[model samples]
Target: MGYQFETEKVVDFILKNSVKKVLIQLPEGLKPYGVGLAKEIEEKAGVTAYVSADPCYGACDLPIQEAEILNVDLIIHYGHSEILKEAQKRIKILYVEAKSNLDIGKVVEKSLPFLKEYRNIGLVATVQHVHKLEEAKKILEKNGKKVFIGSASGLVKYDGQVLGCDCSTAEKIKDKVEVFLYIGGGIFHPLGVFYTTKKPVITVDPYTKKILNIKEIGEKFLKRRNTIIAKFSQAKNVGVLVGLKFGQSNPQLAEKICMKYLKMIRKKELEIILTKLQPNPNPKILLEQYSTPPEIAANLLYMATYSFNDIVGKTVCDLGCGSGRLAIGAAYLGAKEVVGIDLDLAAIQTAKTNSRMVGVKVEWVVGDIEVLTGKFDTVIQNPPFGVKKHGADLKFLRKALSLANTVYSIHKSGEKNRRFIEKTVTKNLCGRITTMVETNLVIPYLFNFHKKPKYRVKVDIYRIVKK
Candidate 1:
């Protein structure tokens, strides 16, 4: 089936708005292509164009605050529809539809050589390309290979619609098959499949109609992380930092923190209130159902085990509290008062319920630790990590000394900036810092959703007191 887009209509819309600065949201699969199109449009239309490297999976999963900051007149968001209707007025969003035009038979034909003598093979692709799945399966099966079609749904926008960029279908049944074949246009389609499972991945590019062999497992891991980081850098104001959390779900703690601030203080508010929530306490039920992200356990344990004295009856803070675990632990240990802050409403909501359950009188404030203010006697928090959350450690450490006379921060151990932090603190705050503790947390079977084995995250605990 051949389809055509109204390019003139898009051009007319831009012309009507007198738009010069345009932001283009590329699809993950089509980012490299979209970048080219964006550059072409800029040259032809004589407009300033920005192509976001971070192609949204579906709708507006990525935050639009960065676009708003750019003062962009129009957003050329490709692959998905406009998920956020509110940003429509300030940001004119035009979603470009991206559908597969590859020859499935040719893709199947090209993949035969890599099959070797394997009898069982699995076929998968992103939701937009899933229509070719059965055809791919039939072709593989016809060649005397047992074929399995992965039944996992990618990120869904509304109902029954796949998120514009997800390979859940490939990831779900990757383990069952001996070889995985990715029949898509770009490396993005196969990269997800390769990461989630170790099955040898082969990608067939639709644009060129050729199959390319992928890298080995180790290289693929590093590639996936770099690809994700490249996408994340396009945003202006907002940043995501992930680390070891104490819970099962690998939720973006930094994102949850920013969302919390969005709720508490409207965007119109001038002075931003910066706060942190580190939820402590874990329900065995969640762990029983799913393994916790390795980083979570690593971070919380670092905060709990670090020894600091003379902090009793002093106001204390816990940033990115997952389930109020650290806050409750602080209160129990005799802090004058303790405030637990987190962006995850579920975590904060759970913390409140758990606080009552455990009979702890802890103040649970929901906000971003990065924007938190007001001085305190002591500030301690196991901020979200870099593995899952990216900006928390830097943000938390940067703001810690400003928040209290005595600052304690827990972050990934072995980071190169430990000495730099010591230097900055001594210079800025006129204080000397001391390393209090170092902890290592290794959790196996925690990342059921991850492609890698058990993760071991190192935690560094620093205790900073005034000179």
Candidate 2:
């Protein structure tokens, strides 16, 4: 069955606004349908429609600039909410949520046994299935169970709908419900509920016809995190990595965690906020990278390089060197040979300029880290968390471990990650974590989809040493 694209509403909105030229933007998954969507809009509304080809990350990444560049009178955005209020005033937007058509009745039917235990259940779904949640709600209500779908509040405008960053809908009704019923697909959204509320979750995946009880998953997560916490009890000379990616950097929270750890752990006299751009804890210079914060980066660096032959005269490599922050920092710290690698040409160019501005000498290369091969005394990197590309971080870990005896890297903090990171590092790289630190990363709102000034991300910095 085809997904529901309410394009007629798009025409109504365009005609109502009396717009002529329209700019249409779609997310990566919905881009395949953009051409057809644009053609239909133009034919019905009699407006000139141009589809934005540039990648769209979320609703936050609206094509307002593109609309202005094309001089379009209106924009038809698909697959996300209106993230920026001010931008909507300047550029007229018609948001077309391409909701899915998968029937939740069958899945709800299959979930009867698991859900029978709960008297009341709080229901939530991602934007894709928000429209169809009513069907599932009806089935649940008709049975003995009482259903509670949270009303629209805060950043999210839809009742019971959740964005990746905003899950208030579920959080709001968590106490009222006996169990959480995620009326959508996948473990991701449901896991968020389990993490937030520590409640048993019945994940009704219509596509897979699998009703998953996420209690075991939550227990596994808790067990792993408990272990990591125990290890952190011993960390002395800690580095808190500070990243600058608009969604990943957080200095204020990093400081709090660092201070908290200092109070809890036995002190070794060295605590630094290691950043790729700035080593200091100055939040003003928190240029965005996707890895750990500066202090955490330094912690990882210190952990990886402390026992090393030399840091001032050592070789260091930073994979996925966004804007050359890590590479420049390594050079400034007196590393004799420092190399930074990234696939993004623009980021590499920016890194070069940053290096020049800082008066630092570092070799910058534009290519996949996998293509290059060389030995370094230490390797430090903030690779992608693999949220989009599964095991993307593992690729960097394997490469970094191959090139150096010691590696310092950052990853999203979670119980599932503990076992995975330990198992993967030991099996693939023949390495184990000699040191680790957990801290909150502040992710500022860069795109329209982000309503708050920033979001908090829990991340872990690890120093892996060869066995």
Candidate 3:
């Protein structure tokens, strides 16, 4: 047999523990021998043996609940080593790592020619070939190559052992080794090693007597993955499946997914509400009276409400509020009071009509930012980027800082402009920058100077707090 099932050790464990009943679990490849092992346990150990027909993926996927239902005293998990140290305290589990007994000398010799160009070689193997790593290392050393084996960490029980989800063994010795030689059956382990280390990998399959270089395979896998992600993002509705297995239970991850889905729903509803509002009929070119995009306004309000907790039951003022998109969003997000101030009378009238249409109360004032006076808890604004008018954004920032304790302001994003804004807020305005999020602002073709149907300008939302 190429693999050792270790029937004697299983009998020894059952007898030593005085186990009266036991459950046998094995991987798909080793499942056919499960019945034979169950019979052997009954004959030698004189105990009741039950074999689980369900597929076992790893030691982590133990049939603890099934064993409990059967009232078995112990569980015999084969083909992998221990991963869940906490689960062992709940039940008695004997992990029998069904080690492969195949000689890897011929395969290692086959990989020698491929590794001839490299002097340093990193040796790694799966759990089945972990015990044979030293034997393979000696062969590589005799061929004028220095071999390095990584120390075991986390779920890996032995040095140079690699799991499908973990490649720390390869990562630990990545810098020291020029190339890696993996002795395993499949391409999964070797592909993980190549991606983790980004080093040339030569896989020696002892069963197939084949040697493969996995660089091209890894590249192809990445291309396929990217294509899948691109197609998946275009999906309108998505369903999430949560695993409830002993080792696969992740309540925190599941909760995050649910929260993310709910947030998307809320944003979509808010965007629809904002789109139905009245836009400014007469927009002045010098004031840059471009109405805020409904999607972008919804995102900004959501961030303020959920992420920063600054919107609900707080006094909010939208400076340079063109057609009142930001101010209306703040009110929709449950602000205690909202104020919209704009120099244009037509924009202010549009804002008042829009607020009444949405059934939200907002105090719309037709005035300049410099004339605005009272204190507020939060102020959100999408001021002009000082493109047509110079230093226009600074004027709004200076006035907003004077009126509110916290301000959410949007500005054009660039390295030089960002540095200037940071310096001005900290030094001149006597305020501190709390958060700066980069997002895109869509500019539709509203004016004659506009060249495209729409332009996506990179912008940053600066969350400034008073010192």
Candidate 4:
């Protein structure tokens, strides 16, 4: 009741976009207002609105597949700010943060009695009440207490805001503050703050006018976790459960857990692991988003890992890393750090999901090769063949050479093209082509112009070393 749903903005968006059918998704706390909002949309915008009964944890838990199944043109998701910017391209989602307008002076006054022992207090709140943190800070400072609010980073949108998973704001100011004052309703955020900072946390629920200390809850959670760990340590066999949800899926962590028990993994096994990775859902023609085949990726990584000894325990970068096959393969092959850079956000998102599915860690960036900077031990890339866009391969080669001493790049195979590439790398790029391996690149039907189910094009993989 204290939250603003922004009903007028939702109606205006629907009318402007000509969204005939829309789905309304709300958190459990905000579900009570769903029917009224839907009614308003139907009356004002003249659009059919259906309220989803499914529980939403955060902005990451988007019911995009459900919306797609219902064939809705747009989804109005309430109670959270937008976290998954990539998902918007798949389904049009409008996020209403549902900012609360409740006065917190009474709650802050109530919390002062419990805060008498502490001088320096760190202030934080959920996005709903993040705006009220200054008011709470003023209240605390007036009572002869120092208040500090951490600046925003990553998932934290506001200066004093904290997400259920991200309590960085509290952690950032934990050293300066003796205790944390969380101005939100639930123990979920406060618990995160307590665990992350290991500082005493006091929660002031503005709605209920209740005060709570979360140190005891955090202690109990730790005890439970340690007990589970103790039991798990005794077990000989353990099964990994992968979360299939967009927000819940964490295959990268699961992979790490599994790898802890494994001995030296072979190239064949790495290839098999990579084969299970999900391909880019949306590939652009201009970018030539042809994902490297599993066998080719494995072969390239094997050459770097086994033959050249460049990948293992070394930093690697994948230039124009489409769906992150090459970069992920390098990480799988024991690269200390792997970075995958791409211009397409959609491709980067798919690459992230694929890395999670394979249980490997890779720094995925949504940007062009020109944006990439830093030195790496090795660089691997499958750049455009200069077909749709002329001289695309030269751009990738030049960028790769600048980033790493050793570069493995793929280009269209031909006597004329190979000679041109060799001269370009040697003369202009200040690099020498050490080895050139001719391989067949299998291109599956992606664009509308493709005539066959699949076709093979001869391509040359050049291993260039900086002179």
Best by lDDT: 3
Candidate 4 lDDT, tens digit per residue, 51-160?
Answer: 99988888888888888889999999998887788888898899999999899999899999899999999999988999998898889999999999999999878998
In angstroms, the error of model 2 at 282 is 45
C-alpha-based local distance difference test score of model 4? 0.86
lDDT of 3 by residue, 217-323 (tens): 88678545533443333335566788788887788898898787676537678889999988889888899888888977876787677666789999999999988
Structural similarity to truth (TM-score) of each candidate: 0.39, 0.49, 0.57, 0.56
Residue-by-residue lDDT tens digits, candidate 1, 1-467: 32223456667777887888888776555566766677667776778888777535556454365577778778876665444666576657786665465567876777788787787787766545556777787887888888877564334332212232555565566667887777656665566566666567777655677877675643545545433432332222454456431111246666777785454312112111111232333423222212223233323322333223434577878766657655665565467888877765667787787667656688888776766778778777665454544554656666766777776666566647566666666786676554445556554543336566766766665666676
Least accurate 10 contiguous residues by lDDT in model 3: 226-235
Position 408, candidate 1: lDDT: 65
Poorest 10 consecutive residues of model 1 by lDDT?
267-276
Predicted structure with the largest TM-score when compared to the true one:
3
TM-score computed on alpha carbons, candidate 3? 0.57
lDDT of each: 0.59, 0.75, 0.87, 0.86
**How many clashes in each candidate?**
37, 31, 0, 0
Of models 2 and 3, which has the larger TM-score? 3
What pairs collide in candidate 4?
Answer: none
For residues 246-270, write the lDDT of model 2, one tens digit per residue: 3345799999988866553132322
Superposing every Cα of model 3 onto the true structure, what RMSD results? Answer: 12.4
Once fitted onto the true fold, the runs of candidate 1 whose alpha carbons sit more than 4 angstroms away are 1-22, 27-73, 80-92, 127-131, 150-154, 157-166, 174-176, 185-189, 208-215, 218-252, 255-467
